[model samples]
Target: MSSGKGGPGLPQERKVVTEIPGPRSREIQERRLKAVPPGVGSVLPVYTVAAGGGVVVDVDGNSLIDFGSGIAVTNVGNAHPEVVRRVQDQVAAFTHTCFMVTPYEAYVEVAERLNHLTPGDHEKRTILVNSGAEAVENAVKIARYATRRPAVVVFDHGYHGRTLLTMTLTAKNMPYKEGFGPYAPEVYRMPMAYPFRSELDGPATAAQAIDQITKQIGAHNVAAVVVEPILGEGGFIEPSPGFLPAIAEFAKANGILFVADEIQTGFGRTGRLFACEHEGIVPDLITTAKGIAGGLPLAAVTGRADLMDSVHGGGLGGTYGGNPIACEAALAVLDALDAEKIVERARQIGDIMLPRLRRMAEKHPEIGDVRGRGAMIAIELVKPGTTEPDPARTAELAKACHAQGLLVLTAGTYGNVLRFLPPLVIPEHLLNEGLDLLENAFGG
Candidate 1:
């Protein structure tokens, strides 16, 4: 174990002052269970009192190294000094004038920043929303309006969100979509490149996928083809090298808008500023959230100026879409991301994490595949020497990690993939410490 600096007002060492769900955390959780809806998933039983840099300090004073980044919402780190200060200053000036009602300079400034930051250099426009799902839904609406088509294509095992329209876009169907749909119609599912399990190589895989889509869905009728550059909930699966480019080519030929869902993979989570940059494929539209505003609720859709403008004058926006507070927080987050060299840190994190995960995969036959880009990584667990998934063991392994002070998340259609979304601000030694716990849990 090693000790390193964690911004201001943080401990030099991780101190477990109480048990996993310490007395204070349990008390707060008891109250939370009664007040908050059960639909929201709580990973660990502990309730966090404070967080900064890379550590989550529980109510009972147990400082645990945060590997989940609040589900990748704090890539610039929790309660970042700059973000906190900016949010505080903004809140004091005005809480919510409602951009649609009175408007604000912060909102326009955020939109300008997003226009410059997103993939395309072509003239672009942005629409800020309150959540990733909202951004995605709006993207679909814009695409359908612009293309005058009915069909939307999404990949198998993809997760868009829980909203009705997005649930139709999502592939998984249990808790997110089980009884909730009766989903919106005209969304189609296609196979994504999963090299570890699929038999075909990169180009072949892309060809077969495009062929199937063209044959069944008839590309001309498709309004948009939405994809995650690096599949987030679908086990952190990165598309084969030629896969995305082929799909982009197909979309171009068919007059389909290509939308990149960067909710989890954007803002330097995948080493590159955007995962699509890794393959040099630019989408017509990109949906962003999670780490975009550090920890604030801010999501955006940036796309070709023409397509984004297709919506009628009053068709886009919400009352709280681009609240001043969130816009200010987003600006601070962008500043921190640049000043702290977060994209480089993501690459550095991958260097430490991937090798450790690969070693675990080698020793454990249950680990079917190790994959992902940069800090957004995953290990797909399976029955030894077979393709059969082992979700039971996957859950057990996650529990083991949690017990040992490491927080991990599970994903995949079969729930057999363990994903790691550590904050980019996590210190080298602290990240290794989390990995050491993972190693111990895996019996290394």
Candidate 2:
């Protein structure tokens, strides 16, 4: 058995006894076609039967190297024993009272812990939610309520969530925004400081963005300026050094709330507890979800007390928000983050990925850029001799890795970026092997 929880943890090695999907997974996929909706996209059609460490074992008994971490939700690892134990204990005690109706100590404890752990030590408040989309929506609601403004400003290449307001806030159009509008009104957009693509420096980009908001949207009318300190879906574009702090500074000075959407970059995934910490950008509101409760569905919008408190009672909750079971799992995840040194582990992941990627970039002209912080990193693929996005090549590389039992996730507005979000608990040898497999894909 693997040392920690999260089901029967698979071994550290990648083993494929059958084809990538194998026969059993293919049979299950056939069943899924009849039962599940076509809207639900499966990253890997091979169903995960047992997952642990750095591997996910499908029902066909194929063990694949995990590079996605279930889209960065399992930082500690799948079915982490500690998280599993907490969930089991909580389940035995009582599963749900609908926190809104019955209230639970675990919910309050989780809120208290978030208030303390998030960036600023000032008086803060946290409202738990069910997913990243919910957390973001609530943050926008709170900001709009507190600021009494009709407009919200989001940057270019920033992905908030899938809900109406968030999809409006999201810069991507095809899959996320196409056919989904008429989106929420009064959501304004500005250019983000994409160093690789933009000509300006960090401060210069910030200046231009602020200027555009002031001229185009009128900063006074904007309720909040939402950003991903490190862009999530729009590519793992780490805003240039001064970009985030500059944006936050503008938001504060202009009576606009700065909302950090840390859904993909939070909870030790970015080498820090929050990606904002990397730039000393303490936003007025921070939305967290993905890595908060291991594999559990839990999210929170933690923010300044006065802003969050501005919303009236019964205005900021859902039936499933902050369920006791998710709270318990989150508490255990927090313990693992602190005791097991997850933040440092993320830094170590970057240390391993950056150097190897940089070397690979040196050799492969198709790799246009290698960027990210801590474990949340990516490589942008482009034409061999130019900066034009090469999405076909990117897809080909990812498919090559998938064929070899290495699970890799791709992202970017151009769909030419391959992201790596390995679990912090991934074994070093497994990580090395995964990288080696990735290199082989690039070589082919």
TM-score of each: 0.96, 0.98
Worst 10 residues of 1 by lDDT: 1-10
lDDT of 2 at 424: 94
lDDT of 1 by residue, 216-258 (tens): 9888899999999988887888877788998899899989999
lDDT of 2 by residue, 1-444 (tens): 123223534567889788888898899999999999987888789987778889888888888999999999999988888888899999999999998898989999999999999998799999999999999999999998999998988989889888888889899997898897799999888888888898888999999989999999898899998889999899999888898888888888999999999999999998999999988888899999999999899999999999999998988899999999999999999999999999999999999999999999999999999999999999999999899999999999999999899999989999999999999999999999999999999873
CA lDDT of every candidate: 0.87, 0.91
Task: Let me know the TM-score candidate 1 reaches against the reference structure.
Answer: 0.96
Identify the runs in model 2 with alpha carbons over 4 angstroms from their true place. Answer: 1-9
Q: Which numbered prediction scores highest in lDDT against the true structure?
A: 2
